[model samples]
Target chain A: MAQLSYRDAVARGIAQEMRRDERVVVVGEDIAGAGGVFKTTVGLLDEFGPKRVLDTPISEQAILGAAMGAAMTGLRPVAEIMFSDFFAVCWDIVVNQIAKTRYMTDGQVSLPLVIKTGNGGGLRFGAQHSQSIENWAMAVPGLKVVTPSTAEDVVGLMAAAIRDEDPVIFCEHKGLYASKGEVPDGEIVDSLGTAKIRRPGRDATILALGMMVPRALAAAEDLATRGIDAEVIDVRSLVPLDTRTILGSVARTGRLFTVEENPQLLGWGAEIASIVADEAFWDLDGPVQRITTPHIPLPSADSLEDLVMPSAESVASTVEKALQS
Target chain B: MKLPLSEHRYGEHGVVLPPERSDANDALDVDLDRRRQLYRSMREMRTFEKRAYDLFMKQLVKGTSHLSLGMEAIAAGFGAAMREDDYTFATYRGHAHTLARGVPMTPVLAELLGRANGLMGGKGGSMHLTSVEHGMMGSYAIIGAHLTIANGAAWSAQYRGSGQVAVCFFGDGTTNIGAFHEALNYAAVYRLPVVFVCENNLYMEYTSIHDITAVPHPAADRAPAYGLESIVIDGNDADEVHLAAVTALDRARSGQGPSLVEALTYRHGGHSRADPGKYRPSEEVEAWKAYDPLTVYRERLVRLGVSEDELDAIDASVLALVDAATEGAIAGELPSPESAFTDVWADGGWSWRN
Candidate 1:
């Protein structure tokens, strides 16, 4: 295993997939010559040639719709929607057409399409460009929502997304792109609905997703120092959520706390809480606590933004509250 | 002045039309079988539409069904001419296209009945019928939504080196939507293999086509502007519709380019079962009904040596099949409530959140 950044891992996965299959091609606004906005598709234009690495028009609708079409016609197209927030512009292509094509066709046409975008709020990028709207995508059925928390997860999940016979919305946290992790030299992790245990514990369970997984781990370590053993679970796939892992972890710890960067009202936290309440209510000794951003549009100020999203401190506080209850 | 014939020949014919063989004898030889198929397909669509109208009135179908009764030739002609592997995207009133492409009537009827055996596994009703095996890409209930998808499919075909084509079937009103312009422009810019078959039935629900748009023609004369070939045909005539489709399909398959076929047809029934076409003038409806594609085709077939008994036998066969399918559909089971969440994603499984 070698250490690799999220950006490098994504580039490697895309390159590997393209190299493995001639049908695989990459299309985005600046994916060709400019190597994408974050350079995730760097050197792909030169390595795979122009046909395989295409720079499309600024229209996100066209890029996504064309990707669906390409996938339907036997070509595996990995389309970049730039920022995750930009997915709003292509709802007809992404939600109505691409996601539901197979079911609509009675399982005849499989849309092996992947839409890659960056999520989460940080880097002082402000609201519009840096909102964690992954829950919005997860709300829609027929779409596989994924947020790889680590570089290793990125390589594995992205390859799996490309090869799978369904449309996958592959989200990468912009904050986690520079975070380095040791990825298996070859692709190893490739399950769709399985969550990974980032850190094991017994006193309490902290279920998190995307960039929040690492923060949850940090909080788990901090809680361990205080003799509070907290288990950290990374929800890699949002749509096809691994309920088994979550319920298993929740059963061990009678108390549960969920953390999410999304808003409080309808975030993944609310979903997780509801699932536990509906199915594993007897296993919980106390009410399930959820730590998330306020249900308001993200503010531009960095100071206010810091308060808006769930932090390690907020998670620990929520966990402590759960323990007291 | 009459247009000069091209040097190109099809099946031992001399150059007649630039895109098609112009020699009457040679063209006749090649088009005989195609013409017969077009006639039969259009007849089938007309029969299906008329039967559906009867069923809707009798309350055999729960939801409203859109009948392309008068405009049968356009769907049959263009759809039949498509290559088996080529793609087709259509609007809500897409039953005729699906039938022309040979999707069994039983599934279509079952879908109207909201049965599990339906095309969309009972989720989609009359408006969203789709069959991938026959290349009938799902029809969109939202007007003009399928245009972009069809354009994408065409571009994909070109990208994949399949030499296949795509046909987008939409009503005259769809031309005014943003998707139509965007789709056409994209297809033109990339020289995508596609045909835009605009069924100009002269109304969008209750509104006449003239009231909503400045352009008189459905596609207008925008073909040259978009750098693609364009043609307007009498949609009531199966021969004319088939001929136009053949020309467009040939151009698309041979890598020449895309074409915009404006089929001037009329819808005999209301937009949906709920509307009795109250907005249309009685005289206008009467005038268009005189040129009923089904009747016109039957008359032509009579002139071509098909006896009245033969036509009756064809009619009986179609009616019996439709009746059987309708009965089967009504008897079919509705999908279980648990089925609501089954097809949302692949079989790996996901948690539901209210």
Candidate 2:
């Protein structure tokens, strides 16, 4: 085992998949020689050569369209969008074409492709660069959306995504890239849709994803010291959500608090809250709570950004509120 | 991944066929045979579309379809020009193209009727028919989306030295799409083995090409700006279309580079099942119908000694085939809703893991 950052884990996963299958290729703007804007694809071109690691033009539609064709014909492609906010430029392909091809083709074709992009807004990147659109991804039916909070989950889930015979949106939070953690060697890891329990507790359940997972874990630890005994569940995958795990945890705790970086209105937290209410309503002692980002564009000022995103203290307070309610 | 053949020719003879302006009067015996085959294919497509419309009126089919009634010659022209192994990417109006490529009328009609035996196993209705066995990559419903896909296939073919060309079929309206420009630029820069065929039918729904694009004559003209070889042909004439497609295919296969062939044509039918084309002038429709591909080919065949009786027999036979396919489609079963979960992935095992 070795210490690794989220960015490094994503790189390792891509490198491993490339090594395993010659058909696996990486394409994005400046990902080859420039190592990607976030350096997630650092040293990939040199290791895999130009053919396996291509530097594509800044046309997202062309990039996605090419991946669709490549996937249909047999290549397993991992396309990187510099930022998740840029998905607007290629929505037609993603929503209308890529998401519908499998069902439309009646299983004749499988889009064995993975699209990777960095999201979230804690870095004061402003509205365009800082927006967290995880809900948009979750809304699509055919795509499998995975959000890994730790360096280890990043490597594990990304590897599974590349190997899975379906289109996957492997989203990374820009705020978590440099956060370090222990990463085990070898390809052995957890499956895609299974949520991991970060901490076992009985007072209440705190469910979170991506950057929010760390905050939830920290909140759980802090709550434990105060006798709250909050259980922290890291939702690694969103689309094929681990509902069973969440529902079971909610059943045990009799309370739930979901955290996310996106705004409170239609954030993925709303989906989780609704699921718990509809399926495990009787199991809850009080109404479920959600600690989420402010329902406004991510401000450019660093101080304002700090105020907008939910921190560990905020999540802990929400869990305490849920427990007391 | 070398292609099955490096260079293909008409028979064993090494005679060079005329380029855009093929020897009009000095045609070879093989050329005559090729033209006859082209006529037959176009006739079949024309008959198929007409019958499909009739079926739709009778409420035998569900959903809507984009027909290729007036553009039969373009399908015949391109289909005859390509080799069996060459791939084709078509748009929503792709029935004529698929029929000409040898997808039986039965599955296509079955698809329109929402039957499980349809070409896409009834999954893809009219707009999304795919026949992998016939080298029909699939018809994309998105306007110009397939252009980039075709470019990628061409790039792969070129990279592997396959000598095989992938032909992408789109419409005049697609040239306005960013995908078209980006795809053409890539094809030009890489010199990929791909032929971009624009069946410029003039109208994208109610909007005309002249209203949307600055250069409307041959969308192929835009190709030359990207350093690709471009040609404009009479899409209503099967002979002209076949010659243009043959030349483009030859250039692409020989590693000369990519070519754009714009076949100027018109759709006699509405855009889809419900489009009555009230947006356009009646005079305009009447004017285009004068240049109907079927009439032009029929006149050509009659002049060439294929008597009226023989032509009637061909029409009757095609109509009979269409009727039988429609009846079979009506009798066929709808896909089990359970099949909805079926092709979501390549294997049932993969879905289970998720």
Candidate 3:
């Protein structure tokens, strides 16, 4: 095992994939010479050369469109959208083309492509850059959405996404880029739609996604001190959700709380809560609680941003409320 | 103001027409067998489109379908110019494009009829017909969106050191979209092997190209901005389109980079099946109809010493082929209800429950 930063782990995964498969090419704005804005693709240009590592113009539509075209013609393209907020600019390509191609073509075409983008907020990047809009992509049926919190998950999930036959939206949290964790040596590929139980308990189950996974784990630790055994499950893949893990935990604990950084209305957390409510109605001891960002745009100021986003304290308090009820 | 013939307008833009093949030497230089094949392709497209229109009018086809009534020459020309391995992308009016690329008429008709035997298994319908085996990437319903995608295909070919060239068949109005500009710029910068074929059919849906475009000729005026060599041709003339395509494909194969060919043609019918095209002036339509690509090419074949009896035989064969395809498509089965749940993911596993 080797300790690596989340950003380094993602780069390592891409490099390893490129080395293994010559068809894998990376395209994005400033990803070649500049090594990407977050340096997640650092050293790729020198190792793979410009042909494999392409720096496109500031047009997200062209970047994604080209990637889709390349994928159609037997090339595995890994495209990086600089920020998830800018996904709106190329919504037609993503929603109509990339997501719908395989199904629309009736399996005649397979788009082995990956669209990696920085998601979530914490460092005051403002409304446009900070919002976690995984729910928008998650709502789309064909797309596979994966958000890795730790360095280990990033490496494994990134490798899996590159090798996946379908288009996978790999959402890398900007807040976790500098965070470090021990990753297993050699190649690691985690299956999509499988959630990992980070901590095991019996009082209630906390399903966390993206940046909220760490917060949920911390909250579980806090709850343990107060005689509350809270189980924390990190939802690695949002689209092919591991209902088995989530429902099993809910069945044991008889309580569920979904934590996320996105808005509460029609958010990823709400989807989880709805699923638990529908399937495990009798399993729940109380109403399925959702700890998420309030239904408002994230503010630019640090204080206002802090007030909007969910925290470990909020998760703990939400769990306490669910347990009391 | 009425739009003049595209050839007449080309001189005003200082666009020099490629040297035309003289009629005297055209018979000797052009391969007789290839010319016959090109004529056959045009005839098949014309018959198929007319049949599709009849089906739509009879309420047999489910959704609206676009016809390439007068734009058959461009499709036949590009088909004659490209290899079977070369990738082709087209706009919504792409039936002729796929037919010319060698996609069977039965599956093509089946797709329009939304049958299980369709090219996309009744999923894509008319607007999204694709045959990857034949190198016809797709027919994008969204206008101007496929330009960059075609550019990427060309980039992949170049990266792999493949001699293949990617071709995009779009309309004149597509030039006004931002993706067109972005795609052209990227293609030029990367020296990708792609040919942007704009079938300038005068109208984008109901509105004339003059109303939407700033420039009269997109290929002649705008292509130069991206450092691409642009050629303006008489789209009704199959020989001219074929010559231009050969030149562009050769340039792309030789690593000379991307080029644009704006084929000046006119659609005989409305953009979609429903409209009667009341927006067009009757005189203008009549004037353009005088130069129907099929009629012009049939006369050329007669002048080139092809017997009238032979031309009749070719026409009869095409009609028979179209008839067989139409019957087969109508008799095709409907997709199963469970089919809606499949093909969304490569793993054959849809995340959502039924």
Scored by TM-score, the top model is 3
Better of 2 and 3 by DockQ: 3
lDDT scores in order: 0.78, 0.81, 0.87
Query: Candidate 1 has which clashing residue pairs, if any?
Result: B6-B16, B16-B22
RMSD of each: 6.2, 6.3, 3.1
Off by over 4 Å in 3: B1-29, B352-354
Name the lDDT value of residue A141 in candidate 1. 73
**What are the per-residue Cα lDDT tens digits for candidate 2 across A153-234?**
8888888999988899989999999999999888844577899899999999889888888888888888888889988999
Tens digits of per-residue lDDT for model 3, B1-354:
112243252322232222232253244345778789889999999999999999987877888888999899999999989987999999878999999899999999999999999998899999998999999899998877799899889988998888999999999888888888888888888899999999988787888777677887865569889886557777878877887888899999999999988888889998898778888776667756777888888888888889989999999999999999999999999987878878899977565531
Residue-level lDDT tens digits of model 1 in A1-325: 9999999888988888888898898988898999989888898999999878888767777677678777877888899989988887778778788777666655667788889998888667887888888888888778888999999989889888888878889998999989999987865548677789989999888988888898899888888877789999998988678898999999998888888888787888888899899999999988888888888878878898888788888877778766755
Reference-based lDDT, residue A294, model 3? 88
Model 1 scores a TM of 0.89
Model 2 misplaced stretches (Cα beyond 4 Å): A188-190, B1-30, B159-161, B279-283, B304-310, B348-354
lDDT of 1 at B324: 86
User: Which predicted model would earn the best DockQ?
Assistant: 3
Question: What DockQ number belongs to candidate 1?
Answer: 0.33
Chain B TM-score in each of the candidates: 0.88, 0.89, 0.93
